[model samples]
Target: MEEEIRVEFTKNGFDFDEEEVILKKCLSFCINYKLSASDIVSSWDVYSLNRGLELTVRSSHMGAFLEQLQNEQLNKVREKESGLHLYSNDVAMILDGEYEEVKEDMLDTPTSKPASANKQPSDSTGKISGSKFSSGKPQESVTPFGQRKSKFAVQSSLNENHIKQIVKVEDHTNSEDDIIKRVRPNQKCTMRIMSSQPKPGCRFMYDRIDDKFNFLENRIKKQAISYVSAGICDEPSDPSIASQKSIFAVGMICCEEEGRLKEKPVLLQSSVEHSGGQRVRLDFQKLNQFSVFPGQVVGVEGLNPSGHCLIASKIIDYVPLSVDSSDDHPSKRQAMDQNLQMTNLSLDVPELSLIVAAGPFTTSDNLFFEPLNELLAYARRKQPQLLVLLGPFIDSDHPELKKGYMNCTFDELFQLEILGKLRDYVEYMGSAVHVILIPSIRDANHDFIFPQPAFDIHPADFNHQIHSTPNPGTFCANEVKVACCNVDILKHLSAEEIFRNPQGGSKHRMTNLAKHVINQCSFYPLYPPAEDVPLDYSLAHEALHILSVPDILILPSDLAQFVKVLSLEARNEGERQIKCICVNPGRLARGEGGGFFAEINYKGNPDSSSASIIRI
Candidate 1:
């Protein structure tokens, strides 16, 4: 079947009014598609538009009304015209510049004189000579109202010497007939204002060097306006033009004026005004001593714009102020006497107790460096979860020391120093303490003359008593587990025969050794069953025992290293699941570093993943 050629409604040919309406609607439609009508041009033939087509304007303003209308209906018009598409280029730069020049020429003429009366000699002939705002030469200028000016004036205003050169955009049609194709060529159209004088909430920061405020004012009125409007807002009329270049970058938000708050700091536009990379406004609390404030005119130092917002490392505040009170009064902080006793070492964690046993590491000479009282006093306030020291043992057999002639026990020799520091550590740890003791080989040696008890597992007694017997152990007044062993130091001696079961006289010594053995077994995790592991054999086992006794454990790195090794060993032996944590020794030495422990429950089936380590 043949389809008759159909014309929906031509209105006896091209009705510019209807076409104009359709075009405006089309441009608005394009905006929804994220396309700007001013940046493109639409062309169509009257022969094609049969079926109705829709068009949308980018912005609802009348200044862009023509362009917006054309843009909106362009696609539909093209579809009706057999899919013919129009094109548009950003002509803002060209049209804007020329329009400014035209405006300037009209302004410079004064109300008494017409713009034409002040025209240059060459302007009437299109060879304009220099004028007030131009190079004294003619420059081409055109306005949407069909106004014209010499090119010489535009060239002069845009000359190399101009500090702030104006940028312009021009929109040209192939023929004047094309303009009339959609509307009356001579008919003036009303413009719709989208925004004027910018929204009130718009704020700006001033640049000191430019001495100009960055205002968001609407100076652009017409899209097709020409560049020659320079005379309208010349350097003199707009005094800031000479010192300014462009509008402030778009990211800035409007806020209260500068110098409004004594504590509020002015920040540079380029500075990292946000912390933690969040868009939230930067606060005074987040600013360090070197932080810059808002509203303060500053220059860029360092900047990163990759994340959510820009981050600036350096900012130069032209008028710097001193905000640090500490600098003005340094002596306000009190000074403590050097000889102050460190008897109280209390930590602030009221919910938990602490038991720390000192060792050879505690000495009178190093009391200053090992300020137990100060460290513990601080800790008591902090109220650490728990603190425990295995034992306090001093070496009495050093070659240079003559403690042998004085017949002083290792503990008695360093008792004052050890006790004083212990008291401090305890004071800081508070009343909630559960201290345990592990006698060292050096602390229990008896010049190799005392028979090593058979059950006496103390390693230093090599030639003494023997019989493969396990001895009782000693405990502190708190009744916590106490076991003395020479696992490290005794490994160097050959006390095989003497290490066997031997006679022991007192019931207290026997009772102590017995208690140590029983506690050792009870404290160890009995995973996979303790088949052949000796009762007082491994230091790792001893550490595990201490860890099992309390909710929290505090130990030095060296001791921590032992615990880590033991945990690994248990995992390797397929005996039990153990977790380990490692920390730097420096933090431990200062008494600020200790491992924080927590337990996690898993519900899903487990996967095979290796343990990971992270440093903070």
Candidate 2:
């Protein structure tokens, strides 16, 4: 057999023209070696800077031929300065001796070593047979993530006997004998097939391909258990509430509505109590006959248990949920038929709402303006009445001018319309919304300089509209109160200016600080009220309390890390109170790229002794 030397180039983020130069350089190096068509085995490929070209020889003796060619070329480069420069600066030859071992097995047989069943590397002198070059070291085998696997580890599991067994199984598909043969644990094989087998003399037919292909079906089933634990069970309309035989009954109901399937009503039974203040259960197997839709918030009546899920024999109706909106009419349809609603809520509705924006705006629009608009729009439509703006909206560190695409200047941007426009926007939106501005590091009065009025605000705008003072704080919305603070001391000023500042040289630092604060509040845990400290109680009540606050709290997006930290805290608190903390569906859905707003509208919570239909 002959040899094949593939030429490849290596470059990272190289422009189109630079690649062309590398190709030309490699050609020049080959010509200098006085290599000819007959001497060349086949083709030489070009790889980028990072990926090198591979050379394969057609015969064992070809290794010597390649080594001779490499030396001849190096001699030519050393002769002329121009050639030397090209060799040193542009092209480098990979020595042939290093590939002496590789020259054996990889080469098409008879001429070199014969192929082996196992493709692991073998001991070869000063060379590698089937190895990959990585950072100057030869790797045994590389994982999908590019890390090398152990060279001594077993490379292949299947043997000739296994291959023969697999062939036999394939030929006997759908036959009882075939099914038994495939599942025999001691049989030599690379794969196992499992399925419910029919009794002897009983006729049975199955899709053999599906059974064979889905060999690891049990493994797949085990993996899906987590999703089930995460409450990803199927839901339909008018779910059943009772089972034919349920010991701890929640309730029972039949579906007589239009397009409904008439079957045995589901029995919702559970061993866990509604520790979240309601009578909720852990399992709904008894209620499986019920036609509970996916979004339905059904109740279960059951006793407590340990280790395993409690069984709920009865199903309670969904709960009533609504959002506070200032507008006279609801904008979207609440999911009433099932249990998913899109009700809009008010910022002042005694439930906590938040709007966060920060300064030194990197986006096209000023940082404060966008969030302010959202707050105002949300307030007007769903008047919760209270709105909180977390922190620094104006940036004093961002530059005003660009020298070119690469050069920028933040010196003059704050003195221009940037600060003035922000103040006006805040005042305009503040008339209808209650804001609690948290000062950030980039604040104008905090070391970084800015015009005096830039931090000043009209007293009328600060009156009942902002939460800048201490104590239990101030409240514009019912049942919800807010407190505001700054990252640094620039006190005795209106709360509105904390988030509104000009951009400057230290803009990046300021932005990061403001983000930290916002994220903290977003994921703040609800410390349990002492009265609710039972060991088995769920944290649902406390979580709902935090969520139910109507005040809109604003913070920076950069605080995402702190928010995650807070989530961990919440999880811990929840574990102590409840056996397991039910993750907020809204939060989970959003993490999965679902829409921002989640709404729920329930008919009402059913009386503990009975059950009723609640439209959500």
Candidate 3:
């Protein structure tokens, strides 16, 4: 009731009294008449309009108004029916002479604007009520309403040429001995994007369920073929059909209801080629152990006696070997071996040194790029050969951006704060340094899709040293294959997965979480992608495929930062086990404080190659 009254008073541009006697009287009237606060406030508005009373509520007029209200109700009852004795004449007499008296306390003019034109109801300190205090949590600059508004500011108001002004640290020599000497100091490592990245400003919206189904169906079919080719299972059959004998079936794991996965009522959705995309109940109760999520496509040797549920005898969660999509016939380990060949790496040889950092690069309090500047300063001193920066560069969820408080557009912000600084860093660091940028879904200036498009900004003028790739991207540094996805898949899968301990799978929780990406063979395997990520199904099928396991997997996540050299053993005889170095560089600036960045010495040899997660 008070909340409603507060809103009305705020809208009306009236000062809310400290003692709140007027507010108390309004509450009293509501209790007596069993009316809502809005109704009572509306009556007060009508009273003010009728009598030409001052807009502000006064104590003297408040009591008389209450009496007048009671009298009006009694009069209405008397006119409608025979209820004369139910009302009291004493209440009607209260307004006889006191109605003449009313009054002020203009309360002085407010320091800030106080009226209907106000955008956010709450301030950083506290909420504003009427011209005073409002009830609720104090709000930061950001609002929940993510209205896609463009033309935030004109070009004249923004500094578009800030990229030219980034300065290098004094006494910072660009010579060999000046570089930060390490175990594997530095070397020539060319960065090449491997995946078919989405173009900047490409379409990702208006996707229907069919587009989504097509991606899932394609995955199931591919997995089925892989299982068969690897000679691990028989030809795939429909689990939905009735069979007394065990059959080789390939399908995706799903829940019966539209919610989190539980043990019972698990369902398997077969591909269109085999089961016409049919869904059947999965009875895992008979099986002692298993691990599955909604989007995982698996081969199962199982029986469906009643045709309603699949009773599994053995489940193949992962395809032991991978087929090179580029090749017609498979070469077990030749392709991967060729990619990993860095020739020779002695202790004295110059190795590839890189600094990997993710965003929002600025602190939440302001967009000053202090943390980013610090990172660049550190990078310049270190003089790393390669620099990989991921985005939410101009974060949409940023308080200032969401509140529309900045004097420039999102594009302008990115140009000034991120791209500008990066261009400067490259120029100062000289030709030896190359930068690889990957966009995030939260990047306001770029396309907000999971298989996100690269930033539209051109970097040819910067000696072609700086460039961008789509989210969930794969690239090569020298001969070392690096696959990096800006999306927080570890956190996403952690929230959605029904993880159970399978045989020989017990390890670090972080490793287990990250292994899902490699084992599932997709950058993002969550069926219904996280509520926050704008997973574009049309582009995801082509973009999300991890065709060849990368030598280094950069999966930046909100989870705790680590540098793990994971050993994924090949399940098939012909294929060789892969040792992948997974690095979550963490965010350079976490919330309002500094976080971490990864300094990678990519020897491309897991035994020799090592990474350290250093605090900013």
Candidate 4:
């Protein structure tokens, strides 16, 4: 195959000395274009000989080579633009440049349009024309606030026949068993709130404030000591010890004053108080890279000759995951397995299916919650055993809520709009479907703090099927242990993180964010959380910690939704390795349109489990 490609290239007035490199580039191009080797050779022949252009393959620069090839073909078409010819539909369109006419013709006779018409042309001009065609669809102009009018402007006037066609329910299942299974009322499920849920009147007092600040300092000190034990850093040192030459010191990053903007100069407060816990200003100008949000415990190697500002030479913000020798704990492993036997009954089920969504369920235009209605309809059709909904049920930021425009209070709005729909859904789906609701900080009707408590719903009949858990909550569905929080930690981390390695691999940012959560062993690990996130440090110890690696981690964020299976290496050699499936089911509504949700199918094994981020 390689010889054939090389010979064909030579025949077409093209030559390359590095045959292997050229072959690899050709292979990549073929894979990207979904073309076979023969197709590539044939295309090159036509492009080189008939088009009267000498094709050159740059072995080291595939992008440039392909660009040159495309430009050459376009030039040929331009040269022949004056002459009208009955070429293939694609070439003819390119020569004539009558995209609007073609689009109108196709739209006028959809059934008659050939399959080839749907194949998008590859040139830049064709892409622009295609985008223009899409934008020209019958869409109403946007409002000043960027809200779009409903696409179904004439929905009220549409007849039953038109409605039926529009809402046609296509059979999505390939087989009966592929359908989502329903949850039995007596189905064994265990929900445990691992995070501390602040009881009413538990915070805001002076004592609570003191506890929170103490919790922050203690947590940072514990983490710093752990780093020292792991040989990742030395013991904590007073900031005053920093000298003319670079010296390592461990401390928590903080602003010199409370309520200081993030742009203000940061201070490093030593965990160990010496000279009354001296605070030194951090000079990051000398550091090549670092990420230090306020309240983050980090080790810095720097100098402060005048004992005023510590010019950081390097910053280490994270401690490595601990590892231990595998051979040292056979008996301990056996005892752990025995303990697992006692708790494995709930996990005996063969399979479990769940539908997960995060909200701001209502669209920006109005509080009708059309998207929520559609999602519930979908859930009913699928009959998922578990429906896990995370919330901003009565979104604090919604225009209606902000304007105080509702006839009822925020609590009434939640009860009527959010819980009402959920109650009806569970009832309609029968006791076989269970629903779990987790609140968000942005929920107007909920407490505006982290470590939020579950909704206080006390309906007699609904108790069995409806469960509410704290914002940063955990539970077990069948054998799958799940942890979820509705905080937008990804957005926070991306904003504050400063990476030294510019050449970080092409791994997705979502994966890195998930890894950070697991590695730090905290629900909201980014310290000095995003401005909107109200973190009460009094409950920090219990509320934020990840007791054990969960089988599923749901960190719903405003960032683009994704489903990823993360494999976390065991810190202890004898410990069972943990693999977690992470999901970010994006907000249910984006502007006036619907966004996406996640569907998970879990059996016993993490590797065998499947999940999808599906658009509503």
- How close is every model to the real structure, measured as TM-score? 0.21, 0.22, 0.68, 0.61
lDDT of 3: 0.67
The best candidate by lDDT is 3
State how far residue 278 of model 4 sits from its true place (Å).
3.4
lDDT of each: 0.24, 0.26, 0.67, 0.63
Once all C-alphas are superposed, what RMSD does model 4 give against the true structure? 18.7
Clashes of 1: 123
lDDT (tens digit, per residue) of candidate 3 on 1-616:
7666666554333445443776777777878888775556556654653354544577778767887699768756644563222210112321323322210112335567656226443221122124322233323324321111221111111112321221232233343355343323344556666765676656768678888988888888878878776677778888888988888899999877776563236788999899998998877656676777778888888889999988887787765544553334566456665644443333444347688899978766556566677789888776778889998787766665545433334565566567778888877776667898888877776665678877666865774778777788877766667889899887766555554443344335567677788877889888877787778787877789888677789999876677777788877576566778888887877665677788776653665665677777
* Per-residue C-alpha lDDT of model 2 across residues 1-616, encoded as one tens digit per residue: 1111222111011122333443343345457555542223111211110012122212333344446457645645644433211110111122346345434535545554545324323211112223422112233123121221231122112123533454376466535563453344321111111111111122223225443223222212222221223233331211123333322222212122322111222222211221111222244445433323211223444433442334655543321123211112333323331232222232322232233223332221112122233334443332223333322333333221110110111222222223343344446443444544333334322222110011223334344454332111223333323322322211110111111122221222222233222222212111111121111112111111122221222222211111110111122222321111010111101111111211111111101011111100
- Top candidate by TM-score: 3
TM-score-superior candidate, 2 or 4: 4
Question: What RMSD does each model have against the real structure?
Answer: 46.8, 34.1, 20.8, 18.7
TM-score of 2: 0.22
Residue 345 shift from truth in candidate 4, angstroms = 14
Q: Total backbone clashes of model 4?
A: 2
